[model samples]
Target: MKRKLLGVLLALALVTGLAPTVQAKTVPAGQTVGTVLFYVTDKAGERVLVSQVPVSEMVSDLKAGKVDNTLHNYSILDRYVTTVHQEAKGFTIPEFVTYAKEKSAQAALRAMELTFAGQDAIRLWEIDQTGFDDLDTYTCDELYGVARYNYPLLYKYWDYRTQEYADPDGKLTRDQAVSEILKSAEPEVPLLSVLAFSQRYMITDGKYGTGDYNMESLWYTSGLMDSERTPRFMKPMTKEDLTGKASTAADSRYWVATLLLNMKDAPEVTALGAVGVPSAVMTEDGANYYVRFSCPTQGAAIYYNHNLISPSYTPTSRYTGDAVVIPKTNFPGGTVTMTCRAVKDGWTDAGVQTLTLTSSGAEKGWISPYKDVTAGVWSYEAVGYVTQNKIMGGTAKTDFSPNAPMTRAALALALYHMAGSPKVSSGTGFADVPSGASYASAVAWASQNGVVNGTASGGFSPEAGITREQLAAMFYRYAKNVAKTDLTVSRDLSVYTDYADAGSWAKEGLSWAVGAGLVNGTSATELSPKGPATRAQTAAMLQRLGLFVG
Candidate 1:
């Protein structure tokens, strides 16, 4: 029996080649082995961040039976390390070169899996530069990048947001490739995910049920809310709402939706003095354009564009150093990752954008969609007001994406809608703002009305998000010029704590906003003037603007 048991274990190792191992070394309490990020992308290229845990915590969770402990079914290239540190396996990056010199690709690959299991810098290429199926002939001297998989979505709803219902993926038990979006991540940072639905789900039959949501085929997210708060949730589709369906037992239906983190406040890069930069970087020296991401000026809410790196700014770690500056570059296949952070006061919110680039090209996707306007959310009434008044519509027919950041083009459109969607003829005159674009007339109107000035590059960043101060400036102009309201300053910016943080360009508009109560201080003293404004915040501000403009 013992011989059989040993043989079984050995065969398992030999057949599977990649088997899970128990941690042999003890981790000290509170000691961080290393930080690790785990997330995945869908076919459309939208991001679904899973978790960002220290290696120590991951080990703890794995041992505590919290995450996926599934056996490997993919190739050895996909295998990840189970441990790190010198005492553990002592495998380092240069070993790839050494191993390549010593053995075939299979043996070298196996050696890498064993040596760098849980280390951050383990990756498999689609094809090395030599055009092989795998990394058969490795070339790079150092493999100093990120690779370690701990899938949070490979299994069923072991951790869906508080629902005892069926998963949200299938209809009619059909083999239909109905798209599913099940994002139930609990990342270390605060996120405000907006769910855009094509149609609301309801249970037609058990197999063909209609419903709002679930992790089995649903997705959920959380972040920044300043209004009447309640227990946060991600609702599964059913006859009732997600908040209400938590207790109804034996739920047999499933629905499908997506998980998109709002990247409006993601750190952005641009040319230093010029208003324009190349969106895609095909060169390592940045010859295409000067791509530089500046630090958030006044705790502005920047988003996590894909974690693409600056061609010039090399980071010591995978995601710690630089970020993609332009909006997004849509090449294909090859992925470059880095971390993007947003700072508000002393608190920092981290977001991830795994911007994949290739010399070939790439595409961008951070759309959480629209129409998740649930009750008890702070933006509920504001959204209603915007939609009912026809000032702003959702990204799609059913999605009123409240948490998504208000893009510059969207804001222009909203202002245009506020102005009753007036007709204009001439082009926007900016090269980027095409003559026939939907926003062309709006930009033309805004520029003619003095409500907007094109970027330093003399272009309208139609898709770029606006800072709160910028929002204030534009709204202030609209109020003064279009709404024809009082320009009195009821309060001074000095009354706020972080008054010094406001940029010189935004000071007067921010002050006026504060004075007129169009924009309130984030706290008693701090006014987050430069932060990115969400659709919810923009709607609320528009609603408030009506109080005086009316």
Candidate 2:
């Protein structure tokens, strides 16, 4: 066929000639920040990755004259990271693959099919070779413009009619050289397939996209591969199921979201309650991996008691909610599969997705409202104790937001839940803790019982995050006033290097907490009294306070 850019590559070798120096291009819209690794062949015949020339700095590397994309000899891969569980029961492959297939599947494919292919990538490299100072000096569009304006010199300097260059060497013909260079551009196995397949199958589909090689236009993906890494997009579905051979694939940001479930919350006993909505339903901005994905991102509705793992379609379930509940009777062996579909309003729903919940560390099998509270995590058991006993609940439907700062409102809520959500007979004098607010009764009960007090200006900074010493003081009062526990516990705060940083009033509480094994310094020597306390830290302290189960 037409090795169109091949001649341009040959012509550019001797050109000190007429390519215009173009001004810089503005940054493209909706560009995402991510890593794309490039590998070059080493003297050992292995493709050794050039460390700094790869991820995190490639764009800067190009701009700094540290790397070259002047030719297509480099094999590059765009990476998207995900985690996996060692056990087959919690494997994450299905979850990630489901994301790619359901969320933004064919939409990106269609748009890219019309404009992107392997030769487009080749032309990008060829344009860079024009030697107007490489990508360091000009943008991809500027390079393309330079080529568009100057590269047709191929017609003037070379003879396509004679099947040879105007200055061809006797040692090589045009066809032989074109074939060799094209072969070199075909990198390793999978990469070769990507390029050749694009040429043989998809070259004529579309061209003239935005011309921004810095992540505009379209890019190629390996396509969805089944078990053997065979392209599932290739070959027609057989008399049975098949890939149904076809053309090029697009890399999309429209992949579906997934649930990062709390394994400890898996059911074991009589009845596991409806857990919580997923905290990690999707990736990046919570709705899209790509900024252009379907908007007003939505959650999914789970259909459980279906008893099937991978159903052909959405099932008619006995129940539907944000989370799944399986009784010990239905989940006899500690494993139950449920189906889910996205509740996306204007977009396509991810049809019958199968998810499984399994039994965790012990027989009590407490199902939590927080997906962040999982087995093996540092505060797992502590979070379990508080959540199981109703001392704490999620800040959101399914998220504990463990790393988030612990606010006074959350503290009040937890202490109230610990008090069995008692009805408040009187009001808290603090103006901020309104009578109608959710934590009103908790603050009221705690205030009446001397478990807490109003801050300066007669107001509670309910939304403000608390320092570590403040957490110690409030829980200490709860221990003394509400729980009416012994107040004799004490420790030498001087042992900690930062002990003097604690406020005088909080020293008693901090000492008591340290003595009672309810709180530990952030490090062995530093008691970060003024440092912000996170919800996770509070959970651990609460668990050790003898306020709930050990």
Candidate 3:
């Protein structure tokens, strides 16, 4: 094969070096006969990907460093195959195999069968490699391109003792027949098998069938096997016997895997409910790990979210563990806080800050949202207003270090206070809370009031760190309980331009805060909700919400 390839290369070189003149020039289209490129479709006869041409355009794109084409192609092919497999349930193995293979083949074939400049040179390689096959490669004027065709055969490997499909031919067992078809249908070109199979013969055919047989199940299960294991594109599926959905697999899968791994073993739960925690960490160290910062050449905009526990991409690390990072760009200078730590542990340290944004376009007041107030009485009022008024104060000194984190206990107390500190029963002891804690009665009261529930384990980490989103959620609960009364969450703490962030969590609270002229952002777009609510800042927010009017 190597020698043949070398000889072909030499022949082509010789032709390039003027051999055509001595041989009477039989070749048409000069030396570009076999050179071809075109669009390729999926087995469903849909053109999912295309090869760019016009050498100039190709070169230009290459120089510009664009790679969207290859990525888009892979994405389309993956979706097409996955869709076919999922829809192939309840069909006979042979019928399913034939349909899937034909679709795959047609997609590749259509690409090669395209025409360009009145020339078509692509020829398909025979499976035997003995000679070229006309059926493999062809030209399509409609698509204006040429393509190489290949297809994959699908088969079932399960020993059907309980359920058996009718096999009339009697030439081969149902499993044997499917296996034989797969063995014989190997293609010489790239063949994307729609229904990927396991080595032990479990066919991934059923829809919503939880277990390892679902195509992506193997990947997810294997991803958990070895922490260091990295998956390649087409690695064969293994670890099948160990992976059929033990509990509800859907609960464990992320977005991508959930879309791919449709099975019966998946969780019956359909909706994802957001449970709020106070002071959710965004990143680790003094870097932008979870949050995204957008700075324009002249202006600045920051968009933040509390879903920073895991992200698609890791940001630059500065300190370690959920640290704030400010991106560097060409712009006017300003000062930003670099570090702010809670007096207690568990709660993440506010790592770093960027320089304060300049007073170029808009001007707003400045205040540290995470200010410490353990030292001063005036600071305590602000701290208490921020903590006790909102639903984030520690239910007890030991339950939640209001200064430490606003734990679940602290959240309940803050929420109760946010709801006018409603009174309720002090009955059955909570299995989670200690018997003699200050927040214990409040936690029980909060639960009785239908505000917050403890973990399934019946224990709430009274001293655990709280995230900003969680605090928002607590405020939300308080607002709902209080019959939509307005509470000032922030005012005069102008650090944002957008009011949307302020209105995001507790709409009623934000509305009240805004309507009462107590809470306003930096401008109209800068509502840094994810920014920590310091003792002073919280006090200011409560004052705006009408909490400490007395």
Candidate 4:
């Protein structure tokens, strides 16, 4: 059983690896601004930048670099660089670069706009390009361009008030220059806000690409990836994007979205119920132990580890059912704790449950080979014991015929085995008991031992069906003759409604059986002693008589 369970877990693991792969991060379509993106090439290199470029172009540039190893920097006008360096796996860089650039640019731009307002602001732009061209050597080409273009207006105004090419005591800082460039290069189309960023490159179908940029995708990817690999860029979604179509499992953004939507409403396992007796007598058939449990919501399935006592058991999607049957052999006679949980797609686990099981050691002998005697039947244990003890054999190799009536010959043979199959003192005692008959010696031994007697006309009716009262009388005689125990008068027979109808010869045995808790009346008041005994009833009675004791 343990080996079989292990095989199933390995199979599930293989299947999971073959299932569809989902991207860890996704980017929405269209232009985005004020968003910090990480451009990375494996563990060797990465760059942090705030870009106003369309998401599609950004992905294309990154992939091109990944292909050729010569990824060029994007146009500086549309992007603000925070830092440039290689980052090893599992390391995270600071996010202050984009923030600093945005703040510095906004401050410088605001200062310039206020200083050159009214009629002078128009005059401030009249300066020529000669003096500004030299400023190119002092900065990056993109930054120089922005500063150069704005330098003319500032120079003309300063000259009108102080007669100089620049402020001698107040040179523009780098932040101020970058700020001017940003203000002048602002795109005509409004930049979309960035909602989220990916910490790792998105790979799909053996090809790398950026997927949809939305909160659903953002949350989905976030839920799927570990904290170290989670995307860094995130922006709130607009009201319109919030009302977009729902995502499915096939979508990269689905899992995270589903997790967020259903987390709180996930089902919980309310209780676990074991189906039968906690302990069972181990047999050759290897009867299984069972458990039943339920969850609060529909579509929920139960998962459990087969080994109830192993501390290292890893829970997988191998076993699924509201009720599970575990082989008794796998768990020997001791306590075993079965761990279980309720799970479903799109919901959090309901948490684990533990069920304890107890089992007895294997019993010896030839157990019935019948398949019809299933576990949990009332007479199952008794039948197993009786068959294994060799007191009686099944009607055929594969059937016990437990519901069939027990004949006098069968009872005689069963008792004969119980008494160790002793040899008969004489050939045959009754006229009907023949020497060649299968139960001939059994009847002879039973008669000589005073366990049974012949009917009228000195004939042993071996083929006749034995009645409940007659069976009790035979058991009482055997107990006295073989077991050396006399019947005790414990309970009053008056409690039975049919007690008065019981024959004088059967009263003592019936009283003994009822007192020992070996037999019961058909109802609270009726003994029904004259009724024929079925195979199942006989097995039950034999078990109560301690046929398989010890």
Candidate 5:
């Protein structure tokens, strides 16, 4: 029954053009019909045999699981036979098996050699039809066999002569071919190409499915199947690709007008002198044009919007160009400093610069409104010097309150500022001085430097009105600690009738003050030691002390 089934299956396969061909002749013992020789192209375009088994051996191998359905199935055989007939015309299939089993085995081995040589043994291979170009009667398998046999010899000679066996006609020995194949089985794909292919083709949804969104097929049809379609592999974009240059004079004019508008709107830039229309210089290298704007004065800060490019109210002395570079960032608007100098000798110009910010509002320096303190006033110079030095600030944002009584704490803070406001760890050595108080650090620093002493009650009395005598005593100590100098009372104080009434502790301070020419009496007979010192008086004393301290 198994023999009958085998016979029936073979008959069916033959009818379907799936059986291996056999030559019509006497069958040798132990050999069977069913061995076919044909050629097919491999992936690398090299010709290789479809199968290497004799028909009898193939049947036995198939039954024994030695040759699986994938390689030996009737369907595969039928397609293989049809492809060979179409590709290689006039090829015939024989009806009877012939040849000894040993000869069939040798043929199978030879076919295996052809297969290995064409596909795997040589690093490169191709058909040689140089002498057979006019031949049309030859079977495709015959032609393939001829090429296969000559490929290795030709490759070996070419490789030996050129040392480039990667080409089809290159010569190479069997060992050399095998070594080349072993070194690299396939060509390497570029990293960018692989990345592009993965990004475009390897879809997560419905992979390999045909659809409008199938990028692989779409790209293949569009002639962009490779990674050359990717941006990194393509030509790079120039600056013009991002933002175009102004082509016409009108366009340039419009840009210049817009830039001027932006500069005018910038809060930090105060245009000084005649700010003529801005201009730009275009370089040969196609760099961004360098814009220039002219200002009246040389020493002034320039700003692009709120960002300060130049800090001071002056420009560099070496800048002799008619225009300055319009300072700019990645923000809108521009700024230039506008400064005014006072005509009077004692009056301060404040050196204020107006800022016109892009996003935020404008910022200006504090302008005091104490109208009584004018340029020609007696205390004007003193107040101007102290205020300009930032040694003191007004009581209010605009009010100086020059006539207000100066307190001990206020005097300590003013002196501290004059001393550059050194860092203090803790409060003054007085029970009444709280840590959070504004003058706490100042009082602490003053006490630490022996510039001030607490009252008998072990309190700083920060809020108490500072008398002229007490002020003089503190200044004397400041001079001792900071200036490293002791005062010698060289001026005569006997002219003041009230001078003897001054406390002993303050007498020496008053004598020093008189000798230093820092103090004057209301009259020749009075030294107002107990009188409260006014803000104006304190400013005058600070102005004088500044000269002596340094």
Candidate 6:
């Protein structure tokens, strides 16, 4: 019986390539020690090998129950041994080896854990087992590792943010969610360091839906009463009803609409300066035009016109930049013709276009067309409505000089006109201006509007030519509500990298203008702030400040 058992064990070992050694015993008839191999797997699933002794030696150990004792230390062999005993004839050697390697509690536990993790585990396996160096090649699990181990919490957050029956308040508090996600990670992993991995795995803000409307609504609600205090990216605000904050109904919506425009699709085309009626775009037949009136000065009316040929407001889109297209049914031939004439209160023009059709004409999508010519040849159709409505021309000229260098006093006059040419009290005792100066009322109004202050002690330098850099500063202050009337105090202009040598006269304003992207230097690092202002640069800066644009 001993010989028979030894012979059976030897045969099994020889066929399975398991244990090679056995005490001198009957071996399988055609099998040799060289044919048998015994391998095991570590807890990590790494292959390891036991002794590869002969089948006769293996049987001797088995008879003494030494193989069983060996398997005790290497538990992976225990089950395989039992299987071998039950079906020794059909047991495959590779199967025996695989069973032996999967011998530890750690290995079994890991396998069980992986099973629970499901797809996450598979993703982990593919990433970890692969030898690729590129991070993109890693599976989500390989990328996230233990960080993604908790399936239940992940599911919970997913459910909370989605599904009809989800918990309303259970949306993972930022802390709760981040904490749970971090806990599953390895000790060495940095918190939030795995963002790329999360992105890779489509975790968190992945395929799951966005946050609830209630949460999104918080952006609009933080300062619901105070339009000035509202944060960006908030929900839509209702009309001008005071939200306990000093705000007009128009204030919150404009910003909210801007935010919505940026987030939902493209950037929004927003009107700057002063917001006015025609809140929405008007359509004529198949064409569309968005028009709004804004005041750059106290009494001025500035109209903005945008066509619907292509509606976009993002930097990447066409409508967001400086380029503008004025829609026309036909160029020179159609109802529109170029003509030189006196138009708008303060300006006359050499080149202007007049439209035969009005907004009520059969040719749809038409508004009254006009042109600008005084300063040089430039299109004024966009500004026609606003300029025509208000007397844009100064006292002497019926023509508006589009390219003329503005003076401190000229700007003051323009601003006064913007403010509806309000009656001036005068006699404020400006040391520089005589009591009868032409711009005294305008200067006084400017002081009232906080657009400017005197250049010297109670003296308005109305005749000083405005430099590009200085105008940049003036517009900046006007927009920011800083200059009292024109007496913008001069500061050392060293703050700007481009205009380090700017003259004292325009230095402070130049610094602010360059900083605000209002001016690009003439050279690599020279602002030449004292240089005369050009029509185009002035227009561009004013446009940036929500002032007049052409």
Best by TM-score: 4
lDDT of 1 by residue, 1-550 (tens): 0011110111223423343343322212222113222222223333322222223332333334443332211000101211100001111224322322122111212132222222222222110011112322212222223221221221222111221233434331211211111233222111111111111111222322222212211211211121111101111122122223222111110110111222223212111111111122332322221122333232122223332333211111211112233323422233434323332111222332223343333322122234487655666666766776778888787787778889888888788888887777777777888887877888888888888877777788888888888899888888778877656433445645578888888787886676555686676556887788988889888866654454
Report the candidate with higher lDDT, 1 versus 4: 4
The per-prediction tally of clashing pairs is 48, 10, 63, 15, 19, 47
lDDT (Cα) of model 2: 0.39
Task: Give each model a TM-score.
Answer: 0.34, 0.35, 0.24, 0.36, 0.33, 0.33
Which stretch of 10 consecutive residues in model 1 shows the poorest summed lDDT? 82-91
Q: C-alpha displacement of 523 in model 5, angstroms?
A: 1.8
Model 1 C-alpha RMSD to native: 25.9
Best-matching candidate per lDDT: 4
Error of 5 at 321 (Å): 38
lDDT of 5 by residue, 241-352 (tens): 1122111111000000000001111112111122112122211112111222222322111221111332222211111121222334522234333221111011111222
Candidate 6: list runs displaced more than 4 Å.
1-386, 389-391, 394-398, 420-428, 448-450, 456-458, 482-497, 503-526, 534-550
Please state the error at residue 9 of candidate 3 in Å: 79
**Lowest-scoring 10 consecutive residues by lDDT in candidate 5?**
251-260
Write the residue-wise lDDT of candidate 4 on 1-550 in tens digits.
Answer: 0011110111223333442354422222211121122111111121111111122222232333311222111111100111111111110012121221222111221121111111110000001111112211111122212221111112111211121222223465534533432343311111111122222111122221111211122333333322221212111122122122112111111101000101112222221211121112222335655543444433233444443335223222222221345566656664456554443321234334545545444434333478767766777767876786788788888888889999988999898998889877687678887899999999888888888887766787888889888898888788778776424322455645678777789888887666444566776456888989999889888866752121
Which stretches of model 5 miss by more than 4 angstroms?
1-372
Worst 10 residues of 3 by lDDT: 252-261
Between prediction 1 and prediction 6, the one with superior lDDT is 1
- TM-score of model number 4: 0.36
State, as a TM-score between 0 and 1, how close model 1 is to the true structure: 0.34
Per-residue lDDT for 126 in model 4?
5
Q: How does residue 199 of candidate 6 score in lDDT?
A: 6
